[model samples]
Every structure is written in structure tokens, then in C-alpha cells.
Target chain A: MTRDRIGALFFLAVSIAYGLMSLDIRVPPFASEGFTARSLPLALSAAGTLIAFLMLVLPQKDGPGVEPAGRFLAGLGGFDWPRIAGLALNMLAYGFLLTRVGFLVSTILFLIVGYRLLGERRWHVLLLASVPVVVVFWAILTQLLDIFLGSALGRWGQLLAAQFSGGA
Target chain B: MLDGILTGLSTALTPTNLAMVFIGCFAGTFIGMLPGLGPISAIALMIPITYGFDPATGMILMAGVYYGAIFGGSTSSILINAPGVAGTVATSFDGYPMARKGLAGKALAIAAYASFSGGTIAAIFLLIAAPALASVALSFQSPDYFALMVLGLTAVSAFAGRGNFLKAMMMTVVGLMLAMIGSDPVVGMPRLNFGRVDLLDGISFLLLAMATFALSEALMTVLKREKISDAARAATQGRMGSLKLSGAEVKEMAPVVARSSVLGFFIGVLPGAGATIASFLAYGMERNFARGAKKEEFGKGSIRGLAAPETANNAAASGSFVPLLTLGIPGSGTTAVMLGALISYGVDPGPTLFTERPEVFWSVILSMYFGNVILLILNLPLIPYIARLLTLPSNLLVPLVLFFSLIGVYLVSFNNFDIYMMVIVAVVAVMLRLFDYPMAPMILGFILGDLMERNLRRSITLNDGSISFLWERPITLTILVITAVIVALPLVGFFRQRRRLAQAGEGG
Candidate 1:
């Protein structure tokens, strides 16, 4: 299938599955609360399936002429999957090591590597970017806001604290 | 108007607010000067810092950053041939060419004035229109609201997809489907959750937005070879010259500004259309309205040439807030990002803001004035100096942007996970931009995805499983009509062009 076709199909399949999922939901005041969760998916499925059918079946009598449109449609299917695979893997890895590695190492390592992969230059630029990102983020999360910065590793931050507090 | 404006000026003049606006203006000017980094990033970066402020003050600071960044984005486009934002790309044509012609001073002056003219005009439009739109929405029933959301989603398909209507429609449908991830809202049950706690809340819209816009842009940059050429470096001399508008120039551009403001504001107020379309439309309007021979002045550095899109884009940015603030409907991704900002601040934009939180409503309007004045002052004289930024190497510039983006995302939710998420997404975003996939629809998808799914379900459920209710409502019908008109527009364009071709053939 073409990318548009594949996108249409993938979306359609999920919509149907979600509709089934919503139908299986349990809720309050409906004879049985069991089916409440399934409603959203059901609705989404209907819309999804309908849209996918249109995408798949409809000829789109009007397009940007036949040749370019065909190439455009076909090309969309050929996303640079290897690069995307790297991006997805980077995210998955970061998500798992989030608390264990601390924000600094994980964020910079990923961003610097990602930047290099995406065609940035200079070793100095990469190294410099990592430090401020860590410190600025640490300040924003721990010192400033109530966002979900995990301090489960807080006590160990004594090393960082000691650095700031003159070796305590 | 003076009383209100002066009162707002005074409110903005407080020491802390003044400092904040100054800080915001400086940061906004630079960030905005960079094409892709924008007000949402500015606001997201500051959200952590503003945690200590009073709510109104916090909001004012954020607004300063937001408006400042938008005005700043116009600067780089005019001088460096880089549009700091997607919306500013149209500005680059006349803007850069004007600089190349050694009219950097004149161009900067005109752009600053145009920014204020459009900004003030649209601010006034927002002041007038938002309340009116809100009051209309106040009378809407649950059925009306459900329909409104659908209309907004349909708008995504209409605006984003121009030549390829079905492809745009397909994208919108996919977006709506992506929104269905996570637990069901009404039943409090996990539909797509698959027993994982992480999936319960669904994908973060910010993450998706990062992936699509920021990440995709970064990805696209990799494939494209650009030497960030600031050709105006030699042209723009030491200090910027006067800000005074010449009488002859003013007389010539007066009508252009007036027409563009109206055209831009109307398009901006629409749910899906953006500054790009509005700017293009305003320029077209100007072309149509131009004197018989002056049409050639366009694309050749005419003052009116520069003014049309500048006025329209800024006006569109401000006007886009009408649906967002009044009716809780966002017109485009930037506004959608603004919606996320509002949510992050615990401020739900709806009738309640008008009824109970008038301060939030009026103060935001008030802040736009302050932000605009700050941007005008900061941008004009600083244009020559700020133009130096273009000479900064991409090697240094790119990594810093990556750093800030990383820091910005992490501060939002200090989970190292969010940071990692940003880095990974930024990479992908960079790649996508390398190719030709439009990033706007993806962010639009991520933002409105869940809302579309919820409303679609609600509309159907309220009607007891019949699709009839969707077509039964008059408002829905009106929306459907508008949608049909839009869907038919491309076909109309195609046939009209084809007819012109036939006429030429006959004449031959």
C-alpha cells in the first residue's frame, strides 16, 4: 500500500480496535458499568473506518495532476524508517533510564547524539550544550516548579548539593 | 481607548512587569528571529520560572514572551533571509530583497510600523470580536459544542491540505484517531490503555508537537544543505536610522495596511487558517487593489509590498485568538500551543473566563498592547545590531537551540523522560523537515486528536447511536456548507485555470 494508503489502513485498524475497546468499558449508572470505557474507541472506530475507506476507495478525481500525485502518494509511504527507528529507540531508552541516569546525562547524551545524527557540527558545541541544559533544567525542576521531577534519587543529589554548597 | 490603553500601559509599567516584559522582549526577539523556535518554546521555557508569580503577573509575563517572539520572528526574515517562524516565510521575499538593495533601515522601520499597525488593529479586533464570539458561544447547547469541535477538526482538513484535499482529510482523520489513544473520558475506563499506567493519559500533545514540528524540522534540516547566508551583513551599517514614516510612503501604503488588516483578521479568526494563508491572501488583495501599473512593484521591494504580509501575519496572529479565548476552539498549531499554555496555567478558556475571570480575559488583551510596544521599540533600533546574529555559525547555533529545546522540555516535567523524549523527537522532527511532510497537521493532530474523538462519541451517544444528529443541526449544516465550499475551492481553481487555458488556445 502507498503511504497514504498505509496511513489510512493503520488508522482504520486502530479505530476499529479502539471502538471494540471502548465498548468493553465499565461505567456508572448504565445497566452495567462494564461497557463505559469502550464508547470513545467505538466512536473513533466509526470515524476512522469511514475516513480510511474514503482514503482507500475514493479516486480523488482532482489531484495535482496524475504523475506528481502518484509519486507524492507513493513517496509518502517511503518514510526514512532507519532514522525514525533511531529516534524511537532513543526515546524508549531515555524513558527507561529516566530516574536512574539523572536528567543531565540522559538529556544531553540524547540531544547531542541526535544533533550529530541530524547534521550538526563541532565537538565543542555538543559538549557545551550538554552542561547548561543540565544545570538550567535542574534549576527549573527542583528549584522552581511543581512538575513531576523525580527526586526518588534526591538523597544522592548530595554530591550535586555539596558541589553547590562548598562541600557541605 | 486612550483610557484603556493608558491603564494597560500603567499596568505593564510596574517594576517587575517592566523587567519581565524587557526580559521577554529581548528573549522573544532573538528566539523569534530564529525561524523555527517560537513563542510556545518561549512560554514553555518560562513556565517553570513563573511558578513563583501571582497569576495575573505570571500571565502577563508569558503574554509578553508570546507576543514578543512573534514580532521578533519577523526581524530575521527581513534581514537574514530566514523566516524565524513558518508564518514569517512570506515576509522574507520582499524583506530580504529590500535588505539586499541597501534599504535595511527602511525595511526595518516599515516592518516595525507594520507590526504595530497590524498588532494594534488585531488587538482591537480581538478586544471587540472575542467577547462577541464568546457571547454567541454562551447560548450553545452540548449539541452545539460537539458540532463546533467537529467544525474545528474539519477546518484542519480544509486549511492544511490545499491542492490535495482528500490527503488533508485523510491526515485529519488519522489525527483524530491518534487522539483516541488512552482512557475514555466519560466512562473513566481504559479503552486503549492496554493495562499500562503510562498509556492511561495517552501521548503527551507536547511530545507529539515536538515530534511533528520541532523534531520534524530538525530532521528535514539534515537532508537540506543550507549555508546560512546573511547577505545583508555588509549592507546594514552600524546603527539603525530613523523610525519616522515618510508622508509619501504613508499615503501610498495607508490603503494597503487597512485592507490587509481586515483581510488578515477575517482569515485569522477562522479556526484552521494561519498567517501564511492570510499573508498570501492579503498580498493578493493588495495586488487586486493596486493601481493598473503598480502591480509590478510587488516582489521588487515596494514598501507596500513589504507591508502587506507583515501587516497581515501579525494581524492574523492576534486575530487567531478569537475562537481560542472566547469559544475554547483553537484555529491553528500556534494557538493550539497557546491553549496548552493556558491549560498548563490552570486557566480553561471558555465562557467562564468572561463570566467569572474577566481579569484573565481583559488582562491578556492588555498584555498584547504592552508586548507590541516592547517589540516595536526593541526591534527597530536593534535591527542592525540583531542582524549580526545571522553571522553566528550554525555549528554553534544549532546545538544551542537543541540545548534550549532540551532544557525547555525537561523543565516542563522534570522527568528525565521528557528530556529524552524531546531529544529523540527533535531528531525526528529535524528529519521530517528534511523531507516534504508538513509538520503543522501532525501538531494539529496531536492537539485536537482527543477532543475530536470525545466530541464525535458524545454527539453520537446523545443521539442514541444515530448519525442523523450530525446532519440535523443547523450550525452543523452551516459548517458542512463551509466545508463543502472549501473542498470545492481547489477544483474551482483547477477548472477556472483550465478555462483560461482554453480561451488562450482559442485566441491563438
Candidate 2:
């Protein structure tokens, strides 16, 4: 009915699923005599399940809770669902676009969108701020550290190669 | 011992190592001064950069960040009444009042000097103590090591924040489960990879650390919209007069600093007791020790009130390294991340580290000395400028941090999938944190899980699969007993609280 109860139920469901999955682990024949792969997992699952069960039975001391089951569904209305969902979608899009669009482009786009969502209204500030951050981080990561940033740069390299070959 | 110190000095005093130390300290201080960043995030964000370095250099850099952040945290506490890190929370008690009284510069100066004194004193202790402790740990067998890990795991429950024992334990279990993913530690067989090639190495420690500390923090910042605009505005308004402590004031605070430094170091050496506890303990002890008008002056900007916690917390930050370096058991989340960094650098930290890699040991220790000097000299004059950074808009800060996290995660594994997985992990971590679940135990559990399992299995094998090996050895038995006591003591407190609540309910 409360957040605590919802958390308990979630943990309980996860423990059960994890316990079931761990049961399918097959120990290799050459493994030495002792605890195998499933040992800690099974133990963890059991401990988690037990704790979750206790959480359900024992009322939390600090807050007001122990309401009806209908309140569990009602609690969704209490949260800032739209904002949270928007943030989640923003992150998902950023991650999805990262490799496709490349580091510099995706990062700048993500920052602009993220800053807006966080209530920064001035478009000029967002545009001015995002470019320097993207450039600086790009220089640091790719040029300084020599980490291979993906996609857009790689595409540029391909185009250069094609043009040089064609010219030859 | 003298030779080791000399050798450490030789290693750490090199120009590159010295530069790394300065960079680490400066970045640590700068980042830790930001609201909601803290020492853990500072350390976590720096790990990717350290991959380019050797083991000793990486460790020296990390060690610099560790204590530098502690020093930096007091700046925010004093200036903005927002403790940049949890350890500095006690500093705000008297610090903000001191600032309100127009003694901001004096309070900042005292805090810097006190921090220097505490850190220097504790480094002296660490120099003597860590090697001796490592020598003692050298004789530890597999079972004893197993018991020690268990003790470390159990001790988390003791300090796992207010009354969430079961939740903390659940988090520990979950962390262990997460650690069990990827390949099997003992047999070299795939266990929980679920047929994904990317999961073969399991989850990257860098990714886990970033997601748990950095990404989750960004999400929470977004949700809360906690702005430092006011603190920033106020920080720029006035002249911070006289960044110097008077002679009499220095003389008065010296003994208090020394006493709290010693008390804080021992507290820091104990597993799971960190800077926050040390600072609060020192503050409380000082309050109790004060008499007459001085006692009443505590909350109203007493110099002793400001000095005690500042000194002790710095000392405790230095002391926390003792367990991590010697026993390979980290008492706090930041040190646990350090342990992960050490492991990533391919230097297994334990008793053998003293003999095998004395350079690593000594360089890190020597770097702390340099780091404290750097902080003392640099922190005073720069306090005004550093305080101004608190005014940086959250919109810019949050996105910048998120960009760092995303790129840092990708750089480590160079895999797009890891970035995707990191996002998922961050979401779960944010939810867990929202529910007041402590992430430290989970991080420690993940860091210690593999070693714990290996030692445990080896011990069992040596004992012919007999579980009694745990209790048969004196050291093992003693450690297990201590672990039992640590775990049980909290449950005792929990029940007592419940009983009190029940009694009050009945009376009402």
C-alpha cells in the first residue's frame, strides 16, 4: 500500500526470479570440491527473499503506512510521473543515439535537451554552454587520452578514405 | 623502515608523480566543493583517467583525491552551510555561524590549518601503522582472511545509516548477486552471462561505480532541483577579511586538534567507522569537554566547535587508508572504490603488497604529505575563488556531470552495450537510493565478493569441506565472534527502539 510495501514486493519478486534462474546453473565437471557457482547466488536469493518477507510483515517505524492494497495503485498518482518519464526517455534516446550519431553530436544534443528539462529556459545559454563542454570533453577523451570515440568520426574517416582513393 | 621511507620519498618526489599529486588534489578539491558531488563521486569520476598510469602513480593520484576531497568539503560547509561531502556535515554547525558573524575568513583559515594538522598527524600514524599491520596480516591464512572479509561485510550493518538493517543486508545480498554475474571466479566457466559476449567479464567495476555514484546523483539532482544559486550569490557579495588566524587562537586550538586527531585516526582505522563518525565524535567530545561559557558558545560559532570536526575528519580520512592498504578491506565507500581502482591496475592489495610493491605503498604515503602541504598553501588564498564555483548553475553542472559519466563509462570498455547497461544500472541505483538504501555496502560487497568467495572455497577445500574450519582457528573464531557481535548489536538497538515506540504508543 505504501512505497515501502511496494519495494518489499518488488524485492520479493526479484528474489524469486533470481532464485529460479540460479537453479539452472550447471557446475563444470572439472570444478574442485567446494562451493560452486550457484552456492552464493542461491544463498543470496534466500537471504533477499527472507528480508523482503520480513519487510512485508513488519511495519516500518518511521512513516505512516499499512494502508489498503488500493493505495498501492494510488501511489503512482502521487509521483511526478511525467517529468520522470520524460527524463527516462531523454536518457534512453541519448544512449541510443550515442554510437549512431557519434560522441560530439549526441553529447551536445543530450546536454541541450537535459538542461531544458532541468528548467533552464534561456536557449542562448544552453547553446553557448553545450558547445564548449562537448568540444572540451571531445578533445580530452579522443585527442588527449586517445580513446576511440565511435560512429561520426569513424564515418568521416571512411569518407576521407573514399575521396583519397577516388583521387588516386 | 627508514629505507622504505627514503625509497618512498624518492619515488613520490619525481616530477611526474608530483604533478599527478597536484592535479589529483586540485581536481578533488574542486569537484568535492560542488553540491552533491562528494568524495565518492570525485574518486569515481577520476578512475577512468587513471587507466593511463602505472599502479603506484594511479594510487598516488587516488590517495591525493581522497584527502583533498575532505579538505575541500569543509570549504562548502563553512561558506554555504552545505557540506559538500557527508563527513563535513559537522563543520556547518559552527562554521556557518562563524560566517554569519563575519569571521568567515578566520573560520576558513582555522579549518585549513586544523585539517593540515590532523592530516599530517594521521599520515605519520599511517606511515608507522600500515606497514606493521601489513606484516601482521602476512601471517593470515585463508580462513582468517575469510573471517576478516566476513567481518568487513558485517560491520557495514553497524554504520549503515538509521534503522535500515534488513534493507542494508538486502542491498548486500543484491550486490553479491550482481558480483556473481559474468564468469565463475573459481572454475573459469561462464555462469550468469546469459549468452551475451559482453557479459563475459561480468559488469565493469568502473561502470558500477559511475552508475551508482555519479549517474544516480545527477538523476536525484534533477528530481530535487536543489539549487546553489543563493549560496553562490551570497558567496560573491562580501570581502572574506583576513585569511589568517591570530596567534592566541592558534595556541588555543592546538591541543584540541592534537587530541581529536588521535581519536579520529583510531576511529578511522576501525572498519566501517569513517570521517563522518570521527568528526561527530570529536565535535561531541569537545562539546562535553568544554566548560561554562565555552559550552554554550558551541552552536554560536565557537572556534573549538569549528576546529574539532574539521581536524578529526581530515585525520579520519587519512586513517581510513590503513585498512584498505594493509588488510585490503575498505571501511568506507570511497576506499572501496579505491580498492577497485587498485585491482583494475593489477595490483592486488594485501599483506604481500608491502614486500612486493613497497614503492606503491610508500609513494602513496609520501604523496599524502605533499597533498596536505599543497592543500594548506593553496586552499587559504583560493578559498574565495573556490567558494565562487558554488554559484555555477545546476543546469550546466548536472549536464556536465552526466556527460562525464556517459563518456567515462564508454571509454573504459569501449563498448556501446556497456553504456546502455550503465544507464539501466543507474536507474535501478536511483530507485534504491530513493528508498534510503545505502549504496556503500553494495559497492563494498561487489568489490570484496570474488575474493571472499575464493578465500572461502579455498579454506573449505583445505579443511576437507568441513565448515568447522571457520571456528577452529583462534583468529578466525575471534573475527567471526566480533562480526556476530557487530551484526547483533544493531538488531539489539533496533528492537530497543521498537520497544520504546511501543511503550510510548501505549502511554499515549
Candidate 3:
């Protein structure tokens, strides 16, 4: 169907779920005098449900600011989804690796991969762009700002040293 | 008031704060010159950097960035016919034409002068108007605050332009729903965290801002497969002539700048009506008021045409700060982001701010003057070198932007969960953007959501379960009544248009 229809259905589902969840919020006896914790969320859920329902049922207006109806699937097909998905995956991987490998290594890998995915394939360019930038950024954070960044390798080394000393 | 002004002058004139303004302006300009980025993104990017700064310095820096972004948007409008921000779209109508005539340098100079004058004039207005308004706002109660918040939210959707009212409202509700995620604010008990401890503290405003504005915007550039570097290279080819304006050209633009600045400032004072609307209105007004030949020259590189929007947009940017300072209410998305930043600094911006932190309140206002002078004197001569940054390839630039945005959020809490959550939010934001939904209303809703609920809860508690307080207080009732009118007027127009269309069809 159309994009607006898809949006309506999505919001409708969200509001219903939200309304159900708000019911699970526990209100203490002392705080339940007039307005409880669940009060605003419940109101918002009802409002969201009503608005979404109206959007689904009402005729979509044709004028400025409103795009003409197009098949939702077709509209989605035109986007460079592969590239976007790659970027999203890169971000996810960075997060996973950050604390595991440390900020410097994780960030450098993130930038190099991001550049490669976006069509920068030059080896020298990738190395030059990623390494120096990451080092400078890392130095700024650790040295200048005095923020601590944990290194997984350093932690492993410490653990090994602790085990040997205990055995001795 | 004199003492407050002197305090502001002393604080704003400090070495560190001046450096903040300079850095903020330079960074803002560079980012704003990039297509698809606006002041909202510019300000959002700076929030991480400002986290360590004192409140006054932080605000001064943000204010400078706000002006610089608008000014930088004008630069792209003139050189590349690409209005990086919506506020500068009208500037391209005449600005690009002037560039085409080999007068890029002259056009840049004119824009700088016009922006300077507009910003300076509006800063004066803010200096006079802010404290007076803050004093009056001191008497506001919880019920009145509740009403005012409702008014601000409704006004945003009302001005969401034709045919998008329901969509904007839906976005607002969604934002409100998002705000209720972490815990029950009043009870301090977890509500919607789904048993995840990471979400117990709730979604950070910085994460939300960066995800929606910065990350999503960069991803959108890649999604569209735009050859941004090619476009930038093409725009930077021509000679920038001389940065000089003849006396006749100055005379023609003088009245337009003055008129548009006043109009822009007033419009900017209204919630949801910011720089974009101000610039367009100013352009239209100048076109209508111009005499014969000058009127024909409108949109054909008329000096008045270029000056009107440039002046008005900067003035409007300054004017938007009024509500943020006086009422603790943000009139637009940029200010909404600023409000979140201010709250993170442990400074609640409201009427009491004037009495409690007069230095912060007045310094922010005073710094606008300094920002304007710096933009004109230092930045004007350096435009060509700055414009060269536009030639940076999208492949390199996009990755860096994404890195910065992701890293900025990650730096705050140092949580891996935040990064994953940000990616998810950015994806959702991209989807919503593709559906033609505006992100500003959602941000506005999110920023105002907690405060609105607090005021509402207090009002309800005070009234002993009676909801009549919504109409019982004169100020609160008046505010709500205005909200009703704002919501109704748009619906009324929609219906009338439908009826007219039906009548014509029947006649045919």
C-alpha cells in the first residue's frame, strides 16, 4: 500500500503495545494520590492510538507538503539499501569491538571499512586516513582530556601476571 | 539591569569564551556548508565538545555556531545554488544569480554585511526584551506552564505546513511515548525498560539528537547516491571577484535589511516559526514592496533580494533564543537541542535563570554581538579558503561524519548499548524521513515531554484530583484557548478547501 498507510499501521501497533506496557507500571500507595506514574503514558497511548486511527481512515489530502501516493515496497526498493545496511553493520561492529579491542584499534578499523564500503579502495589512502586520525583522536581523549580507555590486551596481560604470581 | 549587563560583558569577554565562540563559528560554518546539514545538526555535533565547558561558555559557543550555520548556508546558496539549510533557500533565488554574473565576492560581502546588521539589530532587541520578559514570566505557575507547553507543542504541528498536520501530531505523540521509556519520573521506578539494566537510565537526549539529526542525515546522503564531491567541485570553479560593495548597491539594500530584520525577529519569537519562515516572508515582502524595475529584478540577482533573506535569517536565528532564555521553552528544533544541552549542564533555563544566573543569562545575549563582529571581520576575508572545504570527497567526508556522530554519543556514557541503540534510532528516523515526516516536531515533543508531564502532575496534585484548574486560572485558560485556536484554524482551512474543490467538481 501507500507510505502513509504503512506509517499508520506501524504507529497503530506501537501505540497498542505502548498502552499495554504502561499498564504494567507499578504505582506505590504513597504516590497514587492524584496522578500516578502511568498517568501520562496512558494518556499518550490513547492519544497516539486515536491519531493513528484517524490517519488510517481519513482521506489523504493532495496538496503541498503531502507526497503523492506510491507503492510502499516500490518506494523502498529505490534506496541504496546495501550501502546503508553496510554502514549500520559497521556501526554495530564498532560498538561490539570497542571495549574488546580498545578505542584506537576499533575506531581505526571502523573508519577504514567505512571508507572502503563507500568506494575508497586505495590502500595508501585508507591507511593514511584511518591511522593518523585514530591516533590523534586517541591521544586527545587520553592525554589531553584525561579520559580512560580500557585495552583488552592489557587486561589479559594483567590477568596472566596475577595467575602466575598466585601459583608462585 | 546595568549590573547584569556589566556581568555579562565581563564573562563573555573572557579569553576562553572568546576562543569558544571563534571555534564554534568556524566549525559550524564548515559543517553547514556541507549539503543536507543544517543548524540543528551543527548544534547537535557541538554538544559533545561543550560538555566540559562552563554553562556560559557553552551557551556562547552554541549561539555562535547557530549564527555561523545560517551564514554558511547562505554561502553554499550563493556559490553552488545549494541551500544547505532551509532558511537560505530564498537566498539562492538571487544569490546564485549574482554568482553566475561573476560577482561571487561582492555577493559574499553583501551577505556578510547584511547578516552582521541583522544579527546586531536583533541582539539589541534581545538585550532589551529578554530581561523584561523574564521578569514578567517569574510569576508563572505550574498550571500556566502546563498550558504554555501544550501551546508550544500544538503551535509546532499547526505550522507544520499544509497537509502534514496529522503526521506532525503523530510524530509528537511518538516523541512523547519515547520520553516515557526509561523510568517513571515521579516514582523513580522502571517502567518500559523491558528488564534491561542498560535502558534503566533511559535514552540519552544526546543519543536521540545525534541519531536522528546527525547520523540519519549522513546516512541519507549515502542512500541517495549523491555525488556530493562533484557538485562541490563544480560550485568552487569560478573567480570570487572582489569583496567590495559600491555605495549605490548599499543604498538599495539598506531599507530591505532594516524592514526584514524587524519582521524576522518578531516571527522568530513565535514558537515553531523560525529562520526559514522568516526568510521566506521577508523575501516575499520585499518583492511586493519594491518599485517597478527593482520589483522585476527580484529573483534576478536584485541586491534587495539577496539582502532581505540573508538579513532576516540571521535575525530570526537570534530571535529564537528569546523563548529559550525567558520561558525555558524551545521555539524550534535547534533550540530544543540547546535546551537538552543546557539541562545536561545542570542549568535549568527559565524565568528564574535571570535572577539565579544573571551572568549566564546575560552573557549568552552579549556574546551574540561578539559573534556577529567576528563573523564579519574575521570570517568574511577567509571565505574563499573556507569554501575550499566543500571540495572534500563524500566518500571520505561521510565516514568521518558517521565516526564523529557515533563516537560523540559513545563518549558520553561509554556504553556499547548506546551505540547499538543509536543505530536503531537512526534507521527509524531515516524511515520516517522518507515518509516525508518532519523530525523537528518529534524532537520538540521529546524535549518538552518531561517538563510538560511534571507541570501537569504538580497542577493535578495541587487541585486535589480536579481537572478544572486547566480552565480556572486566567493565564492558563488564556494560553489553552490560544492553543485551541491554533489547532482549529488549520483544520478549518483544510475543510474549506475540500468544500471548494467539491463545489467546483459538481459545477463541472
Q: Which of the numbered candidates is closest to the native, going by highest lDDT?
A: 3
Candidate 2: stretches off by over 4 Å: A30-34, A63-84, A121-123, A155-168, B497-508
- Which candidate do you rate higher for lDDT, 2 or 3? 3
lDDT per residue for candidate 2 within B326-400, as digits (tens), equals: 988898888999999999999989888888888888889889989999888886788788778778888778878
Task: Write the candidate numbers in order of decreasing TM-score.
Answer: 3, 2, 1
Sort candidate 1 into its docking category: acceptable
A1-168 per-residue lDDT for model 1 (tens digits): 344455456656756776666666555565342224454456556876786677676443343333343576565456655655564565556555556666656666766766565456778877776667666766766677545556534434645676889955
Candidate 1 chain B lDDT trough over 10 residues, lowest sum: B428-437
lDDT rank order: 3, 2, 1
Clashes of each: 34, 0, 0
lDDT for predicted candidate 2 compared with the true structure: 0.84
lDDT of 3 by residue, B86-170 (tens): 9999999999999989888999999999999999999999999899989999999999999998988888898887778889999
TM-score of the A chain in model 1: 0.63
